[model samples]
Target: MDISTVEDALVTDAKAHLIQPWPTSGQIGAEARSGLMDGDGIYVTDMEGRRLIDGPAGMWCTNVGHRCEPIARTLYDQAMALSYSSPWYTMSEPSVRLSKRLAGHAPGDLEHVFYTTGGSSAVETALRFMQFSNNVTGRAEKKLIIARQGAYHGSTYLSASLNGRPRDHDWMDSASDLVVKLTCPNPFRRPSDMTEPEFCDFLIGELRDVIETRGAENIGAFVAEPIMASGGVIVPPQAYLKRMRALCQENDILFIADEVVTAFGRLGHVFASKEVFDIEPDIITFAKGVTSGYFPLGGAMISSKLLERLRSSNHSDAMFAHGLTYSSHPIGCAVALTNLDLLEQGLLAHAQEIAPYFQSQLKTLEDLPLVGEVRGLGLMACVECVADRKSNNPLALDLEVGKRIDAHCQRLGLLVRPLIHMCVMSPPLTITRPQIDDLVSILRQGIKLTMDELVREGLWRG
Candidate 1:
């Protein structure tokens, strides 16, 4: 690296390469980091000399932990053997094998793979595939994607548009019209505070209303996360997805599962739908844990029915009409293969068995008056903060409650994502009991310090 003018916290000129949904206040946090990464056992060290526990698993990926030698060696060897080999004109062994391997673990008959460079691109592929399948199967009228509110799909224009998250489209004057946004099966913010089944019915009713308004013939597919992540780690109502599956089947619409945040053992299942949730999707989207963030690889796993339509299509020359240059890149596929082996070797089960212990440790936070709710599955979890114990009114984001908590955690050698009033954690799967304990202890101390700072600033009184 070259010499540059350095600021107190973040780089003055060098910009962070990642998109921030909620950027930290004026250069004092994750925004500031040098390019150097030194020795790491569980946590990594940036050149700036801050050692963070990496609670969010590097944005809920990296399930295998940092610096796994197997993944590194495999990627290096694959690169030396062959890296890019014209995926459009020809397929390599790594790509083919990875597809087969992915198909084996995917739910239902999702036996075919269409690769992409990352998760959002995978969502783009799915939407295009849905439209293509509809047209190929003689249903050109079906062109709408029924999406749920507060759901997150991806950042690409079409993918974000298809996602019903309001914040994603705040600045856009003309909203995307192709998506028919519907209420999600969320228990926390239910319209009537009804039962879970009733919630499903209400959500389904919204979908039906959209179909009626747009005409059932105009709906192409319904896309959702098996268990919502990012929006909130919501384990769907037991019967929610199964009923939604039936709804899609009856309507002759495609079912797409956005498993970017939930797949690859995050939910204690190789396939969240097959092992944990038990609902089959016609198509599934995957990323994050595919290679455990060792390499960027994402894709769509489609059912046999879609494959048949592709084979029997009237236009062979028409193409599936979408692809990415890095689709099934050899190095990425090789790393993913190695990472999957780790998961299969029982890491996922270990995380599952230990989740209760982590949950038990976190239960102590309930006594904290600032804490609202604690929820998650597997190794991922969240703690929501509210102003009053009886009322669920979240402390506003600008008040910097999340920021104060995060900064305090950083000072205490922990890193976490502060989402609105929530302080979330997704520690690596290899994290031990003691590490979990340290994580909670640091978090508790961080909360106390943050509250003190706030009280001192006259934002609140003790």
Candidate 2:
């Protein structure tokens, strides 16, 4: 290998060879994203050697922070011991150990685990298991999945179909008929005439109406993220999740809580569905922070009651017929176990302690005229820029406002996750109070700079 040539042409080669996720048509295979060279704690050094606060925490996965020694050591040690294991034929000790640990942390009767490669695979597994269970129990017609607007499940075909973001389906194909999308529960975007409580009522009534019209027997599951992450961190109204869970129970619709971004210490807990919202779901899909982005690992923690029902069914011999080659990779499982250890050993408590400070400091940004609203829960938050404060409309402004803010923030030593006109912040759980102050300060300056730029360009009047 020509080391010098590769090193000199890294960005050029990436432009020529890489197909980055969510690429635009104009630069699908040629976009050169910001190159990160190194990471330590909640900070990452860019290719230019500028250290920046990891504002989005590596897409909301680096819970315990970057370069965590125990997780890194576990990855190396596990690979040295036993790198691969055929999950179908034999399971590794780490996988079994991780399963027991996860089951212990999981809420209610969610005592069984089905490992997957990542969030998409976890969601796909849960849906497939739902279908498989329905088929075995003699209800083949029960296959519809209920999702919500502004929700993001995953990238796999079936999982992607459940994504409610319009752009996700703009140019791509999906099994749209198999999924039903309800209205987004963002109070900021709710109808102008409806109060917050009324908005909540409307959402619940809509779900009830859908169940009645579509028939609960035909609906297999209702999947939701406790707090919508990728959809600009849209946290629903109070008691919304619990009420939805109750509805799912009454209608016999399996509740699949997609905790891909909310689990594993993100919300200061191993799982957020029960602790944060006081509802125990029938199935919970998790990934991301489980291994703190050190290794790709995810799984669906299924209810034991559901498993028992399937076991007692007449066609119990039928197979689920789904799995991944890396279903229970020894290295991934080992890494997850160590990552959990870090969380259990006070990292989770630290997150709980610092989240309030993080949120309050970010809330101060609302004083900026360009900020439409600041909303989120726990360590995840979104700063939405609107065209006008009174109307709170983002459509009238430049759609690339987020990107502009991100460009300014990066120059000021912070990397933001720009989502259209919104900027999402989910720094690593390992971040301290001073680090949170720095993050908010950088973000505030970034927005102010963006506002000035817009004014100079005749884009806005600040």
Candidate 3:
């Protein structure tokens, strides 16, 4: 049978059996879907054998690239040795070693580790820990979580409630009263008249107001991503994180740094909280690139200070009571250990060297009329489409500008993530300068193609 015939069969089976996440039913089989067959380095091959450069790195997780032999071998060897162990009572060698290694790399005196299955679980664990700590210390009312608009924490019941993205909570029911939201510190989305410094001050002042009104004793934690990845790669001002940390310190609120996307070399570091952002978070939640998308593994790093307090406090006898069956899976830990080695060996340095070039090249897209903004930090970036450059008004949602760009980019031998009216890119850290050039060229053409289509449809003028 021809490859085309095989691809058709697979797509048919997928349409019937697969239920995709975050899309309407009509979008399922509306377009020709590419079934990824394999990945090598920065490229992935579809069922039809088309090799395309992976732009978003499998949801911003594949930092060390694809089909890494060491990672694969580690997974295989660990499975052969010990696949699973009940994390409730028993412990595994790999898990212990990984915890020690991660704690060493983590910021501050965060010396304790609680393993989870993935990013959501890591976040869930952190929030649960905060609640438990508060309850044990006789501060049951201090359970309110403070999350920011445009933040993506996770999808679990408690963690999802902390999500501030509109679409994430529009249809879904959340523990709303339990989570209070602060303004998203997106400089690009800030009011036009406000200067960057003024915008920062405004956001900081708003947090202070929330603390004063809501009462800092009532708030449990303030969760934030150093660079808001899923929220169109919104990078805040340099001093924003430091200032927030101070506020948390002053209020006795636990500061949870959701470094799921920024950690493990995506930002050219093992952990970005202290190394890049210069903040000491009480708890740090991490996942995604921890295993470089090779295995499902995530964890929370607890500060020694907090743990000591919890131990010395009356809640020392209170059971925290939270554990996933796969919390400390040996196979996942083995793969993550190897993944960390790969990052430290060379990929981290490579990412640090090439990130500025990547950001600069993507920024060049701003010259295009359809591009309202091109913003990024390190390997992550986003191109926000706009109907009017002067007003920076976003293009109509019905236009599906990001999807249009994705289609053109796919045709041009590249893959990008479409987030509403924006296209996000965070390719494998191992991507070369030449590959970045190719990626940018395709994006340029894709934007042009999208613009032409919108103009032809009378939906936009460019």
Assess each prediction's global lDDT (C-alpha) against the native: 0.79, 0.93, 0.91
How many clashing residue pairs appear in each of the predictions shown? Answer: 1, 0, 0
Please give the lDDT score at residue 251 for candidate 3: 98
The numbered model that scores best in lDDT is 2
TM-score, model 1 to reference: 0.91
Question: After best superposition, candidate 1 residue 320: deviation in angstroms?
Answer: 1.6
lDDT of 2 by residue, 1-462 (tens): 454454458889889999999898999999788888789999999877789999999989999899888888887898889989998899999999999999999999999999998999999999999999999998999999999989999999999999988899999999999999999999999989999999999999999999999999999999999999999999999999999999999989999999999999988899999899999999999999999999999999999999998999998578889989999889999999999899999999998999999889999999999999999889999999998888988834555899999999999999999998999999999899889989999999999999999999898887
Q: Write the per-residue lDDT of candidate 1 for residues 222-306, one digit (tens) a residue.
A: 8989876777676666677888888888887788989998888787777788677778899999988999998899999999988
Select the stronger candidate by lDDT from 1 and 2.
2
What digit string (tens of lDDT, one per residue) describes model 3 on residues 1-462?
998898888778777777666655567644345589889999998886878999999989998899888888998899999989998879999999999999889888998999998999999999999999888888999998999999999999998998887888878998999998999999988898999999999989999999999999899999999999998899998699999999989999999999999999888899999999999899999999999888888999999997887889965568989999899899999999998888888889999999999999999999999999999989999999888977888988643889999989988889999988999999999999999999999999999998889899998978
TM-score of each: 0.91, 0.98, 0.97
Task: Judge candidate 3 at residue 151 and give its lDDT.
Answer: 94
Whichever of 1 and 3 has more lDDT, that candidate is 3
